[model samples]
Target chain A: MSENKKSVFNEIIRPALVLTVITLVTALCLALTNAGTKEVIKANAEKELLRSKQEILPAAEAFSEEKEEELNGKTFKYIEGTDASGEIVGYIFQNSTPGYNGPVTALVAIDTEGKIVDVNALDLNETPNVGMLVGERDFLDQFAGHSGEIALTKEKAAENEVQAVTGATISSAAFLNSVNEGLAQYAAVSGNAPEPLSPEEQACPDAAEFSEEKTVEKDGNTYTYKEALGEDGSLIAYIIRTESKGYHAPVIVLTAIDPDGTIQGTATVDLQETPNLGSKIGEEEFMQQFVGKSSEISLGTLSDTSVEAVSNATISSKAFVDAVNQALELFPLVSGGAS
Target chain B: MSTDKAKVKEVFTRGLIRENPIFRLVLGMCSSLAVSTTLIGALGMSVSVLVVLICSNIVISLLRNFIPNTVRIPAYITVIAGFVTIVQMVIKAFFPEIDGLLGIYLPLIVVNCIILGRAEAFANKNGVLISALDGLSMGLGYTIAMISIAFIRELLGSGTLFGVQVIPASIPPIMLFALPAGGFLVLGILMAVCNRIAEHFGQPKAELGCDSCAAYGRCPAKEFEASQDEAQTDADRKIRKAGARAKRNEEDRK
Candidate 1:
């Protein structure tokens, strides 16, 4: 009887032990891999934030990240960029409001005089085609010169205020809410009533030329490139733009480059891909691959030499390449001089 | 003697058709429904399930003599989970996008009814070779069913099949067919159509039971079997009562 019981134990207990060992080893490996990749993932996220700032404040000389602060009962992060002389160039303020599908977070740049510089949609989770129209350039461009007192009412308003896009009413309203929140905070910080722009005085024609061509000579190499015009007419120096196609969408990137070719900034201007998978291409490590490459370099070469395509992000990477190629081609046209 | 071997082969072949995991047994509805929205998703899911099922069956059969009856379910689950984890990690490292699409369903395969049911009913009692065959046949059956459904859904819903647009540009595709509700509707109609075909051919309707159904002891086949046993007992009692009545009547006449 004792022998039979021992046999039963050997038969049953032994296989169970083997199975448990196998499971543990497999799980341990997974945990290890995840740990190994976590840092690269985090760096990728920071790169995206920097890139978004550059897109909205094209001419910002350098960005100074401010601690999160609350003004007028709303929370915001005030990022102020300055030129070589330590003068305030522009302010990139992060704000959010409820959009059609979910919260729409945006970064808006305003000059010292309180004129609209540019707006960048940082994160938007809305339905495709219908609510996604909020990210359209024409729609976002409406908030370019807006100030505190000007209401976002769709009428032909003063120079500072403009109409929202049709068929995307909710997205437009969400942007307005974010802008209003930013203005309120600015008022609190300055300890003064916010300035309002008159209808005739609102539009800043000079601001439009910031994205226009400029000639600059550096290290005996004269390059004519479009300088992103900041609110105060400071030249936005370092920029990099990359585009790749994802499995389900196009990936368009715009990044700022420091003189040394280190990534000064990066942002995903467009992405239409699978929700969780291909969308990860927009993450930091993937975009960080383009950090500091010369703007004169073609995006195709950058894509090849930089980060490998996320397995399913091939289509997205291709689209990104195309967008970058267009941005690179446009560089010469915008700058109008030989680099 | 040759006929006997043929009969054995026929029994094995029946699993591929008359007892298919998807069409006949309808064993793995969760994966079939979730990943069938896109052809690539379906293909990825099928490959993962196939690998897990085949590996688990082989391991279970090889160690059948060792598993204690009391802890058999837990032992089988551990084996299945080991294979599943391996598949998940490999996909994550190499095929992250496909990994994302398969998502939670890949891990859920640890509890897939078709796999566990085969392990318990066939692999435990069979030799290693037959058990492997059983796993392969069932997995293939599942793959075929899934791909067929995905082909239809992707083609009609998005005007494309396997990412290639097959339907003309003029035709307005029914987009909802690619959503969750569409998955259920397509699976239901497909199952019903399959059942109708089986009935027309006079084949016994394959039982519809999921892994969860078996765990809860509420499978339709189990219910049917219990009801049949109860009816037989009732008939036996009635027969004895009739016999008693006839005996009493004869005695009275005598």
Candidate 2:
């Protein structure tokens, strides 16, 4: 019996039996622990969510219980924020969007006036020192007390323009998308489904294919380029966007180049150039100067005229011409429309 | 009574300095380096490990006779992982802050070689009381090592101790100390300091990491197999008997 047990039975069966006993006892202990802590864990998670909602909507003293709904194939939880008088003041919702490095989640608060009260990113994890800066004060503060259609810009424009974190456009866009998701969810809940976007509201609204982001380096400045495919899958146009020094803040221009390498059109997308003087770059007469010019188009002296500079707004005119020149230089790369 | 007390004291206190888990023995370096960035994190991890180690030690010691040597590792694992889960649940319930600080490392204590080493080397050979004391003292040694590293890292990296501003505002904290590279730098310097002090006291040089484990140079786990000698046991005897009966029946038919 001793020999039999030593050879096989003791080695396998006995060990298995002992291990089974240990595992069974361990399982019982863990089951007890789970039973004891299950409710507290749930409570802690709920309490954390509530605190986040309160922070996003600072003016709201209290919040209603979560109202869950399915929108765009994602589950959204919305809580109504109430004031001291118990009157519903705003709605806060959490939204998660794919960020540059990971999934970005944020709590968005929009008041009764359809203005974004604030946005608070929850446990943001993005590329540190760059993309992660979206959760910082300077970037997030841009969302406060804003109304109307909101968009990010590097330069300056009129109503509802927020400056994005420089060099972190993707992460900033993720944050913006997070807020937009919340807005869409809230709009659905309030039965205020927004109208479908107009053609102009779409990026390259008339194009067949979506934009493939590209960039060009010139004169110590980076010109962001987006290319679209025309109907029947041909290279359509290259839209060059760049920021250049103007009378005040930087003037931002979007210059379009045809596949054959000539300027299709120029638009002053956003500029903080001085009003009436430097702002003339956005006007048709000033932008028209480079409509047919190629990469050869240079900002002529104030009077010397190949493409005449904007009178008294030379700096702003130079900014416009610089964008067109960047387009002209980049046109060859995508000239065959194969890129 | 006095001699008995001294024996208990010697067995327990040996783990504190002579066989210190982190500084001298250097087992479980992964968790020590990862979570020692903040004092709170260090303290939280240490206490969690303390509970699991002590409990697992006592359990393994009590079951020493019942567990076979060949399958002891797997059995030890089951016991250790069980305690770690319980620790995780308790921390999640009552100490959510520590739960967040320790993150994945809390449950990772199951794989910590320190606990496994002690179980195989000391617990399985000793009584429950002696094993528990070993676990306590070793856990304390690990906790002290973690706290020392965290104290230095936090103080220099953030210019704060336990999240409170300590250094004057004018002295900007060195940002590198908060990073993983800084963790390695601090641990290396502290280890050197520890070894130098040990050498001054006439102690042999301590091995780093699992090398110090008693089972370090032993055969791999596959050696636990019974293939070393295929001695005919009861099953082989049954096969041999069945073969003889078949041969005899064939002879009678012929």
Candidate 3:
């Protein structure tokens, strides 16, 4: 019996004992570390949620999550944002819609007057330079101070059509659908029945206008290069609207050019950038340098160059310059098509 | 005493260049290719690997004497996986953006060949301090390689340096560099460059196939090299010639 006991210890019992001890020690160490980090992780998630909420509902100093509410045939969660004194400030809704690439998640805020304060497209998996234009102020700012089922359009405003980004109709529609869903949910919850706009009424902006004689699509967007006729019907110059991707968002530029493709005038239509830094690209002083410059204008390359980069916002300045360069590059293609 | 110091230096410096975990040794290629698209992703993976490798190596070295030979691999894996889990949990809680970006790759570090290979080859046979040093150096080597790959990929791929735009917008960004294929391309080019530099300094040119690789046994490259050596040996050649002659003689008798 003593020999048997020694054999068991030598052969089977010892390895099992060693493995068990190692595993238990590892588990104990992991448990202790997990306990230490659990709260920190939770706090980080809450902080991000709070920041997103605050961006959409600026008047609210505090937020409380209400129970998930069902409205408009979909489930919605309303987060009530309150001021410091506990008075309700506005209602923020979390909604998502299937975008061009994947789901685009949004946080939509509604003031007490039932108008949309703003729509923040929070998490998006949309195509980077194309569908990502949904986050720009041009698209998002249009939703502000608007009430009822918000409509979208691609054509000239007909007292109803809100502009849709060129070449990214699907993304624009998906984002608008998310906003409309939030409004429907808000209406259901607050007992206010804002009339639902029919699906056909959600008009996306069109490329062709009454005066557009020639139009072509390039780089997933439509461009119409035509002569800007004077009052006497004589050809003045060429004008084109184009888009370019910046460091954080897209910037749209409407550039007018000579018939020979030299620059005439350039103005930014939509720009969402870091207020003081990247936004410096939009200053008249910075833009004026490109006024009479040729298509070959270079920044920071040649000593006697026509353009200078915005001091700290090199990327924004570059993006702005690139957009103008693209318009100049496109002039020949469009003019050739016209000839 | 001098020899001991030199030996220690060799062990530490070896992982940096001569036996780098990514470029030279070619261990842990999965995370090297997958998580190295951006600087943030690369840094996150490098730090996590550093923690797991160091902790597992120390623990395994301390327990080397008692673990049974038959169960050593399983026991080592269990230890490595535990450390990996702890790293994963801490990262998940603290760095959610990085955690989301790293996603499934963080948990996949448990199976990373470098951590397990170091345990089975070096840590189990060395002292605790030496094993710890090996882990730290190898981790640093991996970090350096990952950063180089990510820097090129992000710059050309997104026209950004560490998420800051560096490349002016005049040049169109090559979006392919941000993808997985770009990771492989950058790694190959970087490896070739490193080999060229090493050759210039009189160090041996880096070997390309797996036979000379330092992973645990059963390497196909190693097996192929062993067979080639056997064919080249005088005795093996003589024996094959004699066997052929014997077969011919038997046929003549028939």
First chain TM-score for all predictions: 0.50, 0.53, 0.49
Pitting candidate 2 against candidate 3, the one with the higher DockQ is 2
Question: How accurate is chain B of model 3, given as a TM-score from 0 to 1?
Answer: 0.85
Q: Mind giving the per-residue lDDT tens digits that candidate 2 earns over B1-254?
A: 99979989877766666667887777999999889878999999999888989999999999999888888999999999999998898889899889888988998999999999889888998999989998998899898899999999899987889989899858977767877788899988887787777666556655654433433443243243345334436668789999999999999999
Q: Candidate 2 on A192-218: residue-level lDDT in tens?
A: 776653221232334677466776665
Scored against the native two-chain complex, candidate 2 gets a DockQ of: 0.43
* lDDT measured at residue A216 in model 3 versus the true structure, 0 to 100: 67
Native contact share for candidate 2: 0.83
Candidate 2 CA-lDDT value: 0.79
Q: lDDT tens digits, residues B1-254, model 1?
A: 89957756754665665566887776888889878978999999999988888888888898898676666788788788777877776676566668767878999999999889888877787788778877887888788789888988888777787778799958967766776677788887887776666566556544544422212242446777779989999999999999999999999999
Ranking by TM-score: 3, 2, 1
Runs in model 2 deviating more than 4 A are A1-8, A59-77, A83-87, A98-101, A125-142, A148-177, A183-194, A197-339, B1-7, B168-171, B206-254
Candidates 1 and 3 compared: the better one by lDDT is 3
lDDT of 1 by residue, A104-150 (tens): 87777888777778876755656443456578786787777777744
Question: lDDT of model 2 at residue B243?
Answer: 96
**What are the per-model C-alpha RMSD values against the true structure?**
24.0, 17.2, 20.6
